[model samples]
Target: MPVLVFIDQSEGQVKKASLEALTYGAKLAEQLGTHAEGVLLGKVTEDPSLLGKYGVKKIHHVDHDELTHLDSQVYTKVIAEVATSMGAKLIIFSNNADGKTIAPRLSVKLKAALVTGAIALPETGDGFMVRKNVFSGKAFANISLKTDIKIIALNPNAYKIVSGEGTAEVVSFAAQIESPKVKVTQTDKITGSVPLSEAERVVSAGRGLKGPENWGMIEELAEELNAALACSRPVADTNWRPHHEHVGQTGLAIAPNLYIAIGISGAIQHLAGVNRSKVIVVINKDAEAPFFKAADYGIVGDAFEIVPKLTAAIKNKKANG
Candidate 1:
């Protein structure tokens, strides 16, 4: 059976997480001695055949106006039907908002063994065993799935996206399209800044910045680095930063390539959401701050003094280059 990957897109553009999932699915297909295929729903601006560069051999595209928006129930039914028809033993999804909603539903409908937040590829030597993050990124757990059909939701930023050269054969799939139960009247988008969830780099701060007035430096640093801006829960609760900018155990979880923390105490709750970052740079005046323990590099200095210097240095480097 071929490995089938669900390609997630937003506003006609493919999501980075979906690309990662595609690469992962392609690798898994290679491991299983099977070909990798992709299933795309909704109208996309880019050619679906371009996805073959990530390693899929073919793309089954369902282009319909009703499929533009995410309707988890409808998507589950369509994906289930596709999986059944293609005889796909393994199904891959990116563990983003869309995948989180549909993967579980499809798993229940198909009676497949489901694993979410899969950080690594499965070890198929003995049985199908996958490693995943558990307990809010605190630890890792290897789960064994004993089922004929398996479903995996690859965590965003957990797997590297590998692209080579190839063009997938695009096949238009005629699927039973259903009207979405939920209606989106309007969408308010935050523009002019990198979205924290998909950002390669992030600069976050906390109450230690003292007040909202001090946020200019943080923003300047983020601007210099071209990184997304984030804050701790207390900053958001105090209205210093918007709630959407908050990242912690109870807020948004992010695993960026580079995560820079300024004036944040690095509480366990806060760390839970960002610990998966490849590199953590903590800037705090308090030398004993808990965040330093998890940081790849620690700067023991005042944010007021250090942040400006860092921003200036980055600006100078860019200017010189």
Candidate 2:
């Protein structure tokens, strides 16, 4: 049996989270003394052959134009077909938006043991056991998968994506395609800048920045670090920043390696989204700001004064090097 990883794509391109899933699947395949493969639903612009470097021996593509847009029901049926056909003992998905929607349904359809929000690889000594987060990132629970088939939805940024010299052979998988039951009339796209979900490092601001005019400082620091920019719910609600930059419970959940929050007093809702970040740096003038309690590093200073210095330090280091 082989491990099949579902590669999530958008606008004909694969998401960064898919690479992480590929890496995880590859390593797991090696551990199981088997090989890893990938499953793609629609036509992707990039060459799937290049993805072999991440450890996928082959890529199974459905290439149905009808799959241009994601539908949970249709995609689940197709993925289950691919998995069952390949006799996939283990399957992987990025626990992002698409994975969140389809994983549960897939578990029911395939009768496979499923684990969502998995933080680590499976421990398969006695049986298949996966570790996942619980209690809103406050605790961890080890779950055992009892089915003959296992499915894991990995949390983004939890695993480092490492690629080496290799290329996956592209293969065609013939599966009956069905029209999406869901209709899409129009699409509203977010414009400009790096996407927060794809970003490895992110610098976010909040209402404490006062107004839109002062946001240049935060953006400057973000630019120096080549990081994605984000804002708290309040900033987006007030139109200080676009809704796309919002990162909180009501907005996008991100798991960047380094999350720098400036001027944001952390609310439980906000922390719920970013608590998975490997490193969190909080910068606020208030010494009692709640965000500092959860921060890996903290700076108690005015954003106006501290940000410029931080930017200069990063720039100065680059210059000296």
Best by TM-score: 1
Assess candidate 2 and give its TM-score to the true structure: 0.95
TM-scores, each model vs. reference: 0.98, 0.95
lDDT of 1 by residue, 148-192 (tens): 999999999899999999999999999888889977677687989
Return the top candidate by lDDT: 1
**Per-residue error (Å), model 1, residue 156:** 0.3
Candidate 2 whole-model C-alpha lDDT, 0 to 1: 0.91
lDDT of 2 by residue, 39-98 (tens): 998989999989999999999998988888889999999999999998998999999889
List the lowest-lDDT window of 10 residues for candidate 2.
Answer: 184-193
Q: What are the lDDT scores of the predictions, listed in order?
A: 0.94, 0.91
